[model samples]
Target: MDGFSFFIYAFLSIFVIVSPLSGVVTFISLTSNMTLHEKNEIAKKAVILACIIAVFFAVLGNKLLGVFGINVDSLRIAGGILLFTIAFDMMHAKISAESITEEEINRSQEREDIWIFPIALPLLTGPGTISAVIVLMGTAPGFQEKIMILAAIVLTFAISLLMFLFSRRIHRFIGYNGMLVFTRLMGLFLAALAVDLVATGIKNIFPMLGKLV
Candidate 1:
């Protein structure tokens, strides 16, 4: 691809991963009772964790799949399913945290630090994001392209971290109702992206269909 295409890809990658709207909801849920200082600290930690996780996947996601006897298509299908479920919940504005098993929530509550758990893991870089990155990596034109993708990931996460840190102000400005609407919108986008993933995976698996239909 050319510079323009690369720029667009990088921007989209950042937007998807950073997910400002989702961050708003997550921030409110996680830090509703905390002080500004506490929220800032958590945001810092979460961003660091998110960056580390994304970089790890970008570099070794393929090798990790090999160790488990999995391929990109399997990842795409499984990730698409998971993303679809989340997207449906998003469309409904459901409290995703509430859907977690009671035992898991209890365990998480007992823990002192949650910076790397649900907030940074499934909430940000879940199976869907992982699969998306891996597939994109494969499509990358070369090392330079991969480097730009990484930069986009870092830049986007940085912006997201800042947003979380100021969640209180944003929530006040947008209000609770506005946030809910934004969340659902993001969910709709995610659902559409998930459909694309499934379609791409199916096409890759059934090459003959390309000519038949």
Candidate 2:
């Protein structure tokens, strides 16, 4: 693909997988007792932390994969399956257990470090996001393409930050059902992306399969 097209793909893939809207409900619930200022502070910290985590993995994930002797293609398939499961849960309008559990959410409400734990680590920059970053980096043919992927990551989290900052207002406007509709639509897109990843991984791993097609 050309550079612009690739960048768009990277941005959309990262954005859909991150699914900021899906987390708005959780964010609102967690910060229900806080003032608007406190909520905005948490949102800033969470998105900044999440963005750092994603960039860190995007830059070094492949080396870590090498340390474990794991192939990029293998991770592609694994990550694709993992993302698909999350997407499936999302399509049902359920909070993805892969990211966080009901118990965790309930427990997080009392924790002061909720921004770092559930919000940053798992919710925003979870395993699937990390895997996708690494895979995108691995698949990039050049440094420029890799940079584009990194830009996409930053843009995705920037949008997430805005979403979190206005999460309460957004929830008030969209309502729970409207949020569900958006989540399901994102889920559909993520499912398609996951299938593409799996197919690409298979094709790369077994070039003979490509010839057969």
Candidate 3:
């Protein structure tokens, strides 16, 4: 794809995987007992932390793969499978266990560093998000494409931070069922993207398969 098209794809892929609406839902639930100021603080901190984590992985993840002697295609296949499972859970309108469990969420309520723990680590930038960014970076052709991916990451989290800041208003506006509908639609798109990743990884690993196609 051309630069513009690739940038759009990168943006959508990162945004869909991040699913700011889903994060908004979790953020609302977590901060329901807090004051507006407190909630806003947590929201800002969480988004900044999540964005940093994603950018870190985007830049250095390939080096980590090299350390482990792992191929990018292998990671693509694995990340795709992981994302597909999360997508299935999202389609059902359930919070994916891959991100956070009910027990973790409950425990997070009593924790002092909830923003860093559940909010930033797993809830916002969980395994699925980490894997997706790394794989995206791996697929990028050069420095320019990688920069586009990084821009996508930054944009995704910027929007997410806004959603989190207005989370309460958004929750009340969207309602539970509306949020579910949106989650399902995003899930569908994510599943398709996951499949595409797996297929492309497979083709790359076996060039003869591409010839067959």
Encode model 3's per-residue lDDT on 1-213: one tens digit a residue: 999899999999989998989877888889989999999999999999999999999999999999999999999999999999999999999999998888888888887788898999988898888988999898788889999999999999999999999999998999988999999999999999999989989999999998998
What's the distance in Å from true for residue 58, model 3? Answer: 0.3
- Candidate No. with top TM-score: 2
RMSD for all candidates, in order, please: 2.6, 0.8, 0.9
TM-scores of all predicted structures: 0.86, 0.98, 0.98
Q: Candidate 2 has what TM-score?
A: 0.98
**Model 1 lDDT tens row, 95-204:** 45423333554466545586777667766666656776776666577888888778777777878887888888888899888987887887787788778777777777
lDDT, candidate 2, 1-213, per-residue tens = 999999999999999999999999999888999999999999999999999999999999999999999999999999999999999999999999888999999999999999999999899999999999999999899999999999999999999999999898899999999999999999999999999999999999999998997
Backbone clashes counted, model 2: 0
How many backbone clashes can be found in candidate 1?
Answer: 0
lDDT of 3: 0.92
Task: Look at candidate 2 and give me any clashing residue pairs.
Answer: none
lDDT of 1 at 149: 75
